[model samples]
Target: MSTDVVQIETRESRLEHLPISFFASVMGLSGLALAWQKGVHVLYIASEWVSLVIAAAAALVFLTLLGLYGAKVALHPSHVVGEYRHPVKLHFFPAVSISLLLLSILALNMWPAMAMPLFAVGASLHLVLMLLVLNSWFNHDHFQTVHLNPAWFIPAVGNVLVPLSGLALGYVELSWFFFAIGIMFWIVLFTIIINRVLFHNPLPERLAPTLFILIAPPAVGFLSYVRLAGNVDAAAHILYYFALFMTLFLITQVPRLMRAAFFLSWWAYSFPLAAVTIASLTMYEKISGTAFFVISAVLLGIVTTVVTALVVRTLVAIGRGRSACPNRPARDPGRLETQ
Candidate 1:
């Protein structure tokens, strides 16, 4: 009691707070899911309102933070928006922009008077602009060729896919105008993506894997449209082909990127989930028998398990002071370790 005591303080991690990008990506995902769940009243189960409200809240929160980050990134004298450290040009801008608009439409579920028109306009414009930005590299003659930071492309594609369920939802309601416009935009965007992957990027070796993950948006849009149209034959064939391609790509590429463990680990863990989800969504619409349903269910379960594990792992790592730079170790005397 008479002796003096020494105290120790521990700092909390910034990542535990969740980065704006992550929040934005999640909102985009939730919005897409809700949009897909629009019709099937049974699908909503119990907490549909709660889910929509939460998604809307996430959308606004991320939008505010992303805006601030973008402004800060833009104002930097040395760094341009397309550069590596802060690659805002890729899909971040378009994803968040469309996300907010979509959330508004979703929140106005009962009232289509304003939401319907806005959703159509917003999705069409957003899809076109985003495709152009992503595929702009096809214009090799441009003054500067932006070497995309895969970080932007990866999550951004995921973000794009997040809204895809909207097409399905609208289709269920027989909102022909929105459905038609959205599909047209998606078809065009898909063409651009296909072009860029096939002709633009120099990294042919990297192309398939990246495209494998990136192509989910158009795949999703296509599936939704076909399902909406009740063209099961086409949808089933496409799903099978897509699954085959994805499986082949994943098997080949995962080993190639083995040296890039952290990045590859993230990719390996997340991408298969995406591939399966897209594949299952497509197959779910197509096949009638138990075999198809079982396969689809299994794939969906795998996707859910893998993604949830990754998210929890990421969050826990954040909590333990490994947050932003999880790759860094306490023993390492690097800048990341210092952070």
Candidate 2:
């Protein structure tokens, strides 16, 4: 009876502490699926089956997360509401919708029947989540520049992602609507984040990985705009080249980033690398450049390695019970600002 009691408590604890950021794993896995799907079409080296398997895995993870998070809401309404109001965690609620969006893209090719519904639900939910997060920022008396990080870009990235499948599904006006939101906010957040990073105290180890997220908006925007406008014109050039430069710039910081203690935030590395990989493949397809092909192949290899490591580490953390260790502090330190 005591053993049963202990197990029940442990399970409840796990549910209570389950981070909204876990949806990022779905984002990473889904991005990997899409990148591989694009790779097979562009590189012609891998079987599409590889991507299909990844997409299935992503779908399973998303469903599992959805179920678990639903359970959390039911069993631990206080914790769920707490996360909803959290300064940093508030930005993550959209991750649920973003996961749905990414899965929609993945399913578009594999299970056409599932695509539109997922897109519709995901797109609608993300808009609501984004507005809520923005409202919190606008009205809050507590938010500070210290709370700013690349993860703040999460909502904006989801907006840009809308156009990829949205355009192909013939939502031209809707796609542009999303693309504009993504672009406008990307520029705004980029400026704010740059200022925060340049003169401020360095982001603590946990959030350092989110710096990789800076690569995603432009990389995804490039792909979306190219598809929407039907050409790799000057605007596409600006987006793609900016993404490529950010990729190059962050690669130089890999050594420092690698030294950070493992956190769920490390999954941040996966999706951005995957975004750049798909963007590179798209560039090669459009421009017929061997250099772009080489970049895509290299990035494909790197993202695959990074995501595989993250999965293993995460599983290992769960097995060791550190994934939600009660003593662990997932929250960032308070009051950090410019030097």
Candidate 3:
């Protein structure tokens, strides 16, 4: 009995070490809220109340995780630093900033007064975080063949997210600037990722879900471009079509994704799926047709189901004391890394 008790204590202790990357849950939840909000306008079955409820839930989760993570930082500053220096896990920091930006966008129609301040804070923080991550990329020689994965998109794609609400909040010029940064880096990163995949081995199974992140930039870029341009022009069509093509292309990898062992990293799939769903809904709005509507509906359902499953699984893992901090001991800090 004493041995069993000690084992339980050890398991419980692991919970205290939960990594900052858990903020990925906030990103997933906020994405779900935003997707539901878009669904309210595009689908007859969706309602404003449902969207508001989901948004509220997401806000609560975000606050709760933020507080928990803050506590972890206070108690284990070294662990936090370890995560920051980690090749793969370092990319997840932007998920916190992006989740904040997403929450601000979700609040725009629900509470405009609150939305502006939230957007201001989120946008400023996102820019700073993006710059910091970019600086690390340039100055830090952490690049490694093993570190190349889709999570690298988090910092780059986060810039595109700014313009989603920035345009609506009257920061048109700044939004365009951020949009340009996001798009330019996305192309550069895409080339690097593809080249890595062709020349190097595939990403480890645990990180395969992050491959879904490849879909987010084009989809989000399409939505942001349409909002900024204020129309479905030729350029908008190009973005939309590219997003559609990427989504279709990535769908082929679903079997490989599912075959991998489940981990918190799987949450990487959630926001990207939500992004493409929102993009589809945006297209349906602009090009009113049965086909677009059907596509939007299908993608929304898939994203909602996937995110829900991931949330449930994560909660269960936490309850069972199986979901511990993701940071492992640091290797050579100067290796070129991408996650």
Candidate 4:
């Protein structure tokens, strides 16, 4: 073949070994599903169909990426190990586990037969992954305040995500176990992250969107707590208010976020926004008001727009040979610089 064809073939090979960060798309899509499902109840609209479509898309993306990542593990095991060992990339591993949990939640109402087993698998995997990630945090020696960011919340926050579906699946005891783990470490990590931000250099611009992740634990925790506790008690109120406060605080930072250069990390913003949207809808259910409905509707719109934009950008980047792969040099001349 000619040089052009050879290079195109080579690029395709590398793209197949995409970074673990790609799973953020799954998280975003799952969030969309949850947001819309909640919107359906509050708005009295046919939004559940939208949620189902997004959920199906998320599952397809999850399976496709899983297959690709599996291939990479089989062919380039060292690369996978290297990612797990890297401090920044390691935090994203929970994206996979969390995505599975979110998918299980979607399935819970839509596909009950599959939901129970999916929740079991998702919950089991999340717990095991949380332990492994925490162990890595303790063992890894590259300790510095600058290394802390909201991405660190994933593993710990993911534990709380389990009961969003697990409770419906009759895994009440197991859900509580994971929720306790998630909330406890969420507190520990929340303090550490706050200290790191206040004392150290700011996180790099590429990770700016990850700051949104700080909103997710409390938001998701509120939803999970309500599910497990079966009421909107004082504790649930505290979680809800904190999440609302964080959501407002983060909203003020959107200008800064917009100014930052885009990267795959921008996908970090999608799921958290969706989490808060769900939380808002949950609150709407508890306290009926036009204001609550308005808040939920607006947040849902913002999340849907963001995820859709990111998906389009990713497809464009892929077509242009600009989707950066961790394991190989980007082939297109302007690829690395743009995103």
> For model 1, how does the per-residue alpha-carbon lDDT over 115-148 read when each residue is reduced to its tens digit?
6555565555555655665565455344232333
Model 2 TM-score relative to the real fold: 0.95
| Off by more than 4 A, model 3 | 1-12, 327-339
Q: In candidate 2, which residue ranges exceed 4 Å CA deviation?
A: 325-327, 330-339
lDDT of 3 by residue, 199-255 (tens): 999887667778888888888888888888888899888877887787888889888
lDDT of 1 at 127: 57
Residue pairs with colliding backbones in model 4 are none
Model with the higher TM-score, candidate 3 or 4? 4
- Model 2 agreement with the true structure over 31-131: per-residue lDDT tens digits: 99999999999999879999999999999999998999999999999988887777787887888999999999988899999999999999999999989
Candidate 3 at 270: error in angstroms?
Answer: 1.0
Instruction: For each candidate in the order shown, give its overall lDDT on alpha carbons.
Output: 0.44, 0.88, 0.80, 0.82
| TM-score to true structure, per model | 0.55, 0.95, 0.91, 0.93
Question: How many clashing residue pairs, candidate 3?
Answer: 11
Q: Return the clash pairs for model 1, or none.
A: none
Q: For model 4, what is the C-alpha lDDT against the true structure?
A: 0.82
Candidate 4 structure quality by residue, lDDT tens digits, 176-252: 99999999999998999888888889878777788888889999999999999888899998998898898899889
